[model samples]
Target: MPYIPTRYFCLIAALVTLAIAVSARFATNDYFFFAGYVVLQYVVMATAWNILGGYTGYVNFGTAGFFAIGAYSAVVMHKLFEPPLVVSIAVGGVMSGLVGLGMGYLTLRLRGVFFAIATLALAIVLQTLITNWDFVGGSRGVYIIRPANGPFGHPYIQYLFLTMLVLSTIAVCIARAIEHSKLGYGLATIRDDELAAEAAGVPTLKLKLIATVLSGALMGMAGAPLPYYVTYLDPSSGFNLAFAVNSIAMPLIGGTSSWLGPVIGALLLATIQQIATVTISSALNLLIVGVIMVGFVVAAPNGIVGLFERGVRARRRPAKKEAA
Candidate 1:
């Protein structure tokens, strides 16, 4: 594949977004917007998780913690001052980024399962704190009243969908930029072997920290719209394990090696899950995720992208052999 310029990519993305917006404008069902918003939210999140977990091989299980921090931060803003969604989103990203930095500093020294465990512990600790903090609704939860009409005068759900779509685009562009840059190479080295990377003066810790901060901030931004989307926030729902599970699963199921993987995975899985939620039952959502993920793990361990790449390579080999 030829290397495409970021500007060109952005232009293409803009066109695609405009097309989607036009389609949504004609959409008769508000459910379309609601479902699309969730899928796009996962796109942002899975991409964010891939930054640290896939790129840096950190495997953070504290996704829920960072996500809740963003939601709760938005809730606080709503209660105290009621800033615009954009401001709330920015604040949420900053808060989560700071937490990610702190968490990375404290736990980045540990490697492998130890690091993973530490992240799980971090989520648990944060959830416990949030449960006890009554100001943000504590164990009871809080309600957010969304405006009926959005800034553009469409229904608020459509606005949320558009917001998430833009965010997902930004996340993908960021991921692609990182993947093609020196930072990506540095993180890849750390992912492959942190000790070796450190010995070779790769600044493994710094790179990992950067990945963590980026990942957490993106996750937070993705979560910032949750209050408006759900209209209710609680410790239980805010810190749901499904967020962490799906974030990890989507990247793995799609292929962790590239930016496209998470997007593909999130779109496929979230869409399937949404369909299942409507047709079957919401209770079966996790079960569906587990079944599909297991099938992918067993059959295409490298993920759908990897499977496709392998097929392409196999087909190319015959042509090369014939040429020889």
Candidate 2:
């Protein structure tokens, strides 16, 4: 069969997804909608995180900080003057993108673990600041009342799921576009060796800033909807380290090399975690992720994608020998 055009594939996928989201309301219960929303939210988070972490080789432990910035920004907006979800999400993205840009300006030059440490410090700082900001309830947290009438006629949770699905689609589109662009080549060079990339005129700092802003913005957008989903926002929950851990783990375990890796990783890891949470205990979810991450790192260092590529090449070698 002829290769399908990327745009056509993406368009068809989006339409199919829209169909599912609409049909899902009739077919599935609210619990599935709620759970699916969580999974899709991580799909956006993992994809966004990988733009910087996987592409540029800068591992950010501040995923929670950017995510909370989005959530808290929404809370502040709601209290001051409630806006629609889309508007609030945009505001959140801007807030987190600015933070990322500032952080990149100061610390992007610090290579490797040092840069990661800086991001960790930033997360801690943001968490502390939010904990003291009483307007948004600070450590006490704030409660959000979802609008009785959602954008469409559907229940609010279902609407939230659809919104996440759209956001996840948008994020994946951006990542795939970037992966196939010259920018991706620059990022790969930087990831492999910043010195060589810089020597080759890759505009290292500028590229890093772009990756940081895009990654943080997408992360913020993902977190923006959480206020409606959770109904309560606290620094403790908003700044939970699980965001950082899972975002990092999902991308790593899926394969950090391409756009689809994070999505695959998120779906697999999230589905398994969801199952474990139901049959096992919710507390064991993170432990399972940890064990799986360690195993992937040791056994398949390049992730599921790497293993897949290896398998394909292994099969190809036998075919080549037969042809010869």
Error of 1 at 303 (Å): 0.4
TM-score for each predicted model, relative to the true structure: 0.98, 0.97
What TM-score does candidate 1 reach? 0.98
Off by over 4 Å in 1: none
Off by over 4 Å in 2: 1-6
How does residue 134 of candidate 2 score in lDDT? 95
* Tens-digit per-residue lDDT, 194-251, candidate 1: 7788888899888988999999999999989999999999999999999999999999
RMSD (Å) of each candidate, 1 decimal: 0.9, 1.5
Worst 10 residues of 2 by lDDT: 1-10
Top lDDT prediction, candidate number: 1
Residue 132 accuracy (lDDT) in model 1? 96
Alpha-carbon lDDT, every model = 0.93, 0.91
Best-matching candidate per TM-score: 1
lDDT of 2 at 159: 85
